[model samples]
Target: MSEPQYKRILLKISGEALAGEASRGLDFGVIGEVCEVIKECTQMGVQVGIVVGGGNFWRGVKDGAGRMERTRADHMGMMATTLNCLALADVLEQMGVEVRVQTAIEMRAIAEPYIRSRAIRHLEKGRVVIFGCGTGNPFFSTDTAAVLRAAEIDADIILLAKNIDGVYSADPNKDPNAVKYDFISYDDVLAQHLQVMDFTATSLSMDNKIPVLLFALKDPKNILRAVMGEQIGTIVKEEK
Candidate 1:
């Protein structure tokens, strides 16, 4: 087997990825499959750090109660992310992989609080670190957290596991003729205002020169393929 392309990588998995078919909540089958892929990547010597989203359980903007402030709603969302992270860490541990859940917000009873140096040390020790709570602040999405963690850890790439296979000119689900690029420049993505990721995350990755690999998470093995540098999905980076 060939050496993996990335020595260290940060994987960004949306909460929706954990929801297999249901409209809400997690599907353990999907989580188990994903864990299997992560185990394979770890066995190949790829240092992996994951950041999970919370859309499956809650979305701050979707609540109509009007009782909670926006910041409070967002904090609830962050807690939801921690739940997903804990579940994922449990599954990975069952698969015999050493895993750690580090939350930005302190939840000592459940997991370790986020400490940049400590998280880095965990990765260096070959343990998969899962980051939750979206920078420990409201209004920032998990996508931004992925980029922040990637920069903090000096990661080679950001593996964006999404529902779609790659970034398209338009929403492929809505447009039949949407064009998908095998590779794209960050400037092009920004110019097109593509929804591959939020502006903050995109700009940070671009500035740091960390390529973002956008691929579908449905195919669990794609995670391993991406770390191996297989041409399986769209890759966004600086134009050379």
Candidate 2:
């Protein structure tokens, strides 16, 4: 097997991926498979930090639009992410993989508070650190939180494991003719208004000079393949 291309990575997973075809709740079968891949990455000695989204349970901006206060709705979304993280941590532990869940919003009984040095230390010790809660604030997204955590930990790259295989000119599910990009620049993504990460997340990654790899999570082994530098996804980075 080829050695891993990156020594450390920040993996961003959407909660909808965990929901599988149901797209609204936890699916242990999918979760198990994902954790299996995560375990393989760790066994390869690649340090990983994860940031998970909560779209399956709640979407603050969409669900709460005009129905409730934005702050209240966003807070619910944060909680949803924490729930997802706990689930991942549980499954990882069952697989004999040491895992730690750190929340942006403090929850002493359930998980540790977000601490950069501690998170890095956990990764160094071979523990998978799952970051929950979306930047501990309203309006900001899990995408931005992922970039924030990646920059904090000095990760070599961000692995975005999503339902879609890669970046498309348009939503592939909606537009059959949408073209897939094997590689793209962060500036092009922003200028074209592509649906990769939100503007904030993309800008943050560009500013930090961190590359992001977007690939489908359908085959959990793709995670391992990505670390092995397989050209199986759309890579977003600076051109020069």
Best by TM-score: 2
Ten-residue segment with the worst summed lDDT in candidate 2? 167-176
- Would you estimate the TM-scores of all the predictions? 0.97, 0.98
Off-target runs (Cα >4 Å) in candidate 1 are 64-67
Q: Can you list the residue pairs that collide in candidate 2?
A: none
- Model 1, span 1-240: residue lDDT tens: 999999999999999989988947999999999999999999988999999999999987566148789888989999899989999999999999999899999989999999989998999899999999989988788899999999998999999998889999999899999999999999999999999899989998999999999999989999999988899889999996
User: Candidate 1's error at 171, in angstroms?
Assistant: 1.1
lDDT of 2 at 60: 96
In the order shown, the candidates' Cα RMSDs to the true structure are 1.2, 0.8
Candidate-wise lDDT, in order: 0.92, 0.96
The clash number for model 1 is: 0
Off by over 4 Å in 2: none
Q: What's the lDDT for residue 123 in model 1?
A: 91
Model 2 C-alpha lDDT per residue in residues 1-240, reported as the tens digit of each score: 789999999999999999999999999999999999999999999999999999999999999999999999999999999999999999999999999999999999999999999999999999999999979999999999999999999999999999989999998889999999999999999999998999999999999999999999999999999999999889999995
